[model samples]
Target: MGLGLGFELLKTEGAARRGRLTTAHGAVETPAFMPVGTVGTVKGMLPGSVRETGAQILLGNTYHLMLRPTAERVAQFGGLHRFMNWNGPILTDSGGFQVMSLSDLRTLDEDGVTFKSHLDGRRHRLTPERSMRIQHLLDSNVTMCLDECTPFPATHEVAEKSMRLSMRWARRSRDAFVERPGYGLFGIVQGGVYPDLRAESVEALTGIGFDGYAVGGLAVGEGQQMMFDVLDFTTPLMPADRPRYLMGVGRPSDLIGAVRRGIDMFDCVMPTRSGRTGQAFVRRGVLNMRNARHAHDTRPLDEECRCPACRDYTRGYLHHLFRAGEMLGPMLLTWHNLTYYQDLMAELRRAIEEGCFERRAAELEAGLALGDLPAVPDPLAGPVAAPPVPEESSSVPVDL
Candidate 1:
């Protein structure tokens, strides 16, 4: 039976851990990967398909959902879960990231941000209280506090000022989130790679008290090593019992590193976004299906996988679908990529439970280094050279 929302750390292998997050809809095993479904839908994916990929939770964006469908409309129909037909947990992000990224038509003030919509140039404002109210109306199982994503490469002084401002907003976000049983509110830690500021931010949020804590402000164009370094210093400062979420994070390598460093949850658009662009992620690496060499290949995208795309279609068919601009190509690849990510998470959880996470992590990293099957030449490129493959490329097999 699905338990109400609560996080339980089940096992640990070094700082790396595995856990169960019981939500009103279902039990999600962690460390977990939540496929980004901003605006209540993961593009090119049906909710049932997403569930079939092993995702027990999905992420919605307050900014987009509020702007388009309007939170009230979703609530009127039934909250986000019923509206989207996803019974599993739904985690909603505060509108802060979108407001910061969509900055051209926005004004920033101490209270929050005032912006013109990218959709239709309509005026709007987003403050901590407003953000909380929006998520509450959407009935998010897990809600994030509104905090600015301090831009990368910011000077120490600028970073400090932004961090402090976010801290104040965190308090407001905390005070505004409605307390209810079987729901959670998470505070985001922002310090822009500075250890001292990160510590201060974590301490401030801990003082404010939240159901969970997120390591924010990393993976915003900062390289992996730097992001990992910050996590190395910052995650330990977070309370051990609460779930540790890394927001807006990255590739397979980044997820592996974060899991090793104690992150319990992640949400990113890489896999889905990449899938739309003809990029396919497999256990071996990434492949671009638009390449011309696949025009004659009859093999599945990844022979060892069982996603619908791989189960029912050939590389030649996928290549033709993409070349012909059929929507099915993107849908198939997106499904495969999401399935791969969820499988990766489940494998990690099992590895931790079985006390072999170290070995599994090393193996995954080694496989990533081996690269993907060569992509066919892009027709637009005319006479493009073959993709480079290291001498040891053939060593890694597609296993997912």
Candidate 2:
């Protein structure tokens, strides 16, 4: 399936995989977490900063890029890597998920999907051929096939119908793909939460073939256990030789769990999005930086980490930035959270290579389960009449 590059499965511990994917840009370590750069840039981050966070790859959105500056315009600028100045592997979504998210504005047919841009009311058509063309124009190292993201809680009948349509599209996407040295195409398997449909989907996509196979249509409305259950039965059925990707998923815990179940690659906006919203991820779980508790706390975000935010800034300063609505708040938090995710992936890879995946995963989960460290004790008269709550906002968030 790899025309110019291949995935090397370097090690395994149970279902966990420690592998490397070679691409024109560079090699991506498996169980890799790709930061979402929806519109050609990882928001608030320089390419060097992203590299500092240990990110070997980034994810781009076809729909967003196509809408704003337009894919053709990007091609004129010498593709996404040059336009964005990111010199690593880039994977482009087929624009299918974004199109499906606009269900009210989109129409589906055997040939393709036609939808209006969320930005403007202007119309655009996305076929397997067009998606392939767009990613190619952007010089994507890895391109996803166009496929409908099946809704969760779907009846078997409905899920099967959606999956069949996607399989057809996957074939068209493969046929339309322009193979080049170091670039590869991946097919997405979609089948709601139905096991039978999932099996059928695995068979279909593998038969058609791809450089990698992705498990799509998850983390939509399905709960974590259901999502894990889907993976539990699904990954065992995919090709062992090719990389296995889990798309649009998830929290740190989800990444760990999926890697345990054999997923090699993942992309989601959770870290960056959560960062912008004042949420910071730590090994002991997420902490709300905007909470009044952090406004007085003098500790770094995480004492164990070395990211800039945690290395140079204190929690109090971060809280003040968010309170004042400063731009640097999101920037610092984004950097810290990305560093946490990448560090977790590195640990997982090491665990697999060292043959201690189960033990390491359990230890990581234990830390997260312990929750945010107990509220730092404040002495003297219940913190001296519970220091006046900052009134920078309409209502203060609960201090935890």
Say which candidate scores most in lDDT: 2
lDDT of 1 by residue, 40-110 (tens): 89999988899999998999999999998899999998899999999999999998888999868889889
Instruction: List per-prediction Cα lDDT, in the order shown.
Output: 0.90, 0.92
Please report how far candidate 2 places residue 32 from its true position, in Å. Answer: 0.3
Over all chains combined, what TM-score does candidate 1 have?
A: 0.92
Per-residue lDDT of model 2, residues 27-118, tens digit only? 99988999999999999899999999999999999999988899999999999999999999999999998999998999999999989988
Clashes of 2: 0
Lowest lDDT block of 10, candidate 1: 376-385
| lDDT of candidate 1 at residue 366, scale 0 to 100 | 88
- Please give each candidate's TM-score: 0.92, 0.94
